[model samples]
Target: MSDWSPLHDAAIHGRLLTLRNLINQGWPVNIITADHVSPLHEACLRGHLSCANVLLSHGAQVNGMTIDWRTPLYNACINGSQECVNLLLQYGATLHPESDLASPIHEAAKRGHVKCIESLAAYGADIDYYISHLGTPLYVACKNQQLDCAKKLLQLGASVDQGKGLDSPLHVVARLFSGELVHLLMDFGANAYAKNAEGKRPVELVPLGSPLFESFLEREGPPSLMQLCRLRIRKCFGIRQHHKICGLLIPEDLKHFILHL
Candidate 1:
């Protein structure tokens, strides 16, 4: 195996001073290893924000992709490095690279990085961006049992019913016997009767006679009037203003109710 270069070593080990010194001495900041990995990718994958900033300052390619098609932003999200993610975004890194598996949002959701999800969303990442292997970010979150990430996506207007084949988000949660996820999805208006490719609704995937199974059957009924009203208000606000609805002049309880605060 080829040894890591000095810049890669500095970046991966979080040695900001050494990295800056190397850059100042006219060392190439964008040098790649045998694996086509850049110093910026190393700093980001390891969550070394200072090393990453120094590398970027020295003119490192912010959107450099590895041989496997992972960008620095994607690496940062995989490691749940919020600071690294923010730094890369500030340096004009592409929010959503056309990658093989998932985008930054998918990486964050699969890893349960709530702050990373929020940062990506704030920077205009496509909330519903889908990967063939992972479905949507929300679908990946539910499949990976990342409740907070899934909830955040729902709040940001990610469709809860999206998925391919036998694995809609609701169907995946049902197979895993996650009652809490089921309730949360239902609260966000998931279609319990929506059939998968195998012609099986989510309830059929649940254990035959458990309380969790019973809950799905109970939830199959139509939503209450209050839920319908909340859904309409949320639809009116849409993704851009759902989080901002609290600032409007409304009843305090209603504000909390609307935002799910």
Candidate 2:
């Protein structure tokens, strides 16, 4: 590993005073490691918000990418640093997926960082940004067994069926034999009978004697009319307008049900 510079050390340790001194002494705030990892990247990745602020105030590039194409914003989300994420967004970091295989939302979901996911969603990161290896952010959340993050994504209108190829989110969780996750996905409108590229339903992928497999087998047939209606309404709102459901004059219980709160 390349030795981190004094500036990188200051940022990593959250020593804002030392970082400010270096900046004042004309040290380049954007100086990077051999892998092109900058002080800002280190600060954000370490969740050192104050140090990151100092670097950003000194004109550090918020969108600078590492040698492998990960951005500071991506690092912030990977570290679950909501503070750093907000600052990076405020300074104009690109919220969309660039050349990197994983977007900021994808990183947050992969790490089960619900707060970071919320911050990214609040800032308009595409909730459905797909990476072939990781699938959509929702798929990554499920693959990582991030139940809370998966729930949050569903509430934000993430498609529960949009995994890579035909490996629907349900299929992935079922293969893991997580009955809880499978049920949760179903509640969010996942189609239990949906087949993968191999033309197999989630139930068929489970271990032969697993209770999860039996549960999926017993849930045969299509969703009920009421369930289908609710799913359709949820999709109509989608991620961008789901929050508006909160303003309706409906009763709190109804509102909660509609928004999956």
Candidate 3:
């Protein structure tokens, strides 16, 4: 084993003096452990901000990724360490990196780290970056029922309708019966008429006769004429029917019906 390996061990154990001494003795600050975990990743994971600073000052990669593909920034965001998150960002840490399950913003939002979310956004983190399982940061916040975090993300331009599957932030809020978040999303111009892959709108996702459903109807007002017309067209032509209209085969009859009107 290399002598420099102890620097990561010292960082994990919070032995700042030993870590500093190792650094002073020409130990590379960002040395990785056997598991591909960097000293920076370990120090940040342990909330050893001071030791993290020591590593950062000595040229440790602030955004170093572990064997599991988690960055130090991911650790800070997951642990809700606002100071550490800010420190990492200030020192050139990456807020947006393609990862396995989630992004740093998704981790921060899942845990309702408001400061971390704000910092990441201010640093040009893609507020709309979608993860595989968690969807967008907005969707994760809504799924976890983090209302304040969701609101902050919306204010920062998170797509209120963001999601991949038959889900969206508004739909998740409705499912959780989060009336406040629902109204907040609607007020921010979330597509009230937006549909998921299953063609279900946000309101349709809310349980029938639930308070959230009632509130959704009350706040957004009745569906607009265009919406009502679309529904009528769907009823008349059916959702799956296609017909020739204006010498073109209409793939979606409702679209063709509306266009004809």
Instruction: Score each candidate by Cα lDDT.
Output: 0.87, 0.86, 0.75
For lDDT, the strongest prediction is: 1
TM-score of 2: 0.94
Candidate 1: stretches off by over 4 Å: 1-3
lDDT of 2 by residue, 188-255 (tens): 77887788988998888988877886787667778778778778888877776888888878789877
Tens-digit lDDT track for model 1 on 40-152? 99999999988998889879999988778889999999899999999999999898886655488888999999999999999998888877877889888998899999899
Ranking by lDDT: 1, 2, 3
lDDT of 3 by residue, 90-131 (tens): 999877765645478888888899998888877888888876
Preferred candidate (lDDT higher): 2 or 3 = 2
Which of 1 and 2 is the better model by lDDT? 1
Could you report the Cα RMSD, in angstroms, for every candidate shown? 1.6, 1.9, 11.9
Q: Against the hidden reference, what TM-scores do the models get?
A: 0.96, 0.94, 0.76
Q: Among these predicted structures, which one has the highest TM-score?
A: 1
Clashing pairs in 1: none
Candidate 3 residue 44 C-alpha distance from true site, Å: 1.2
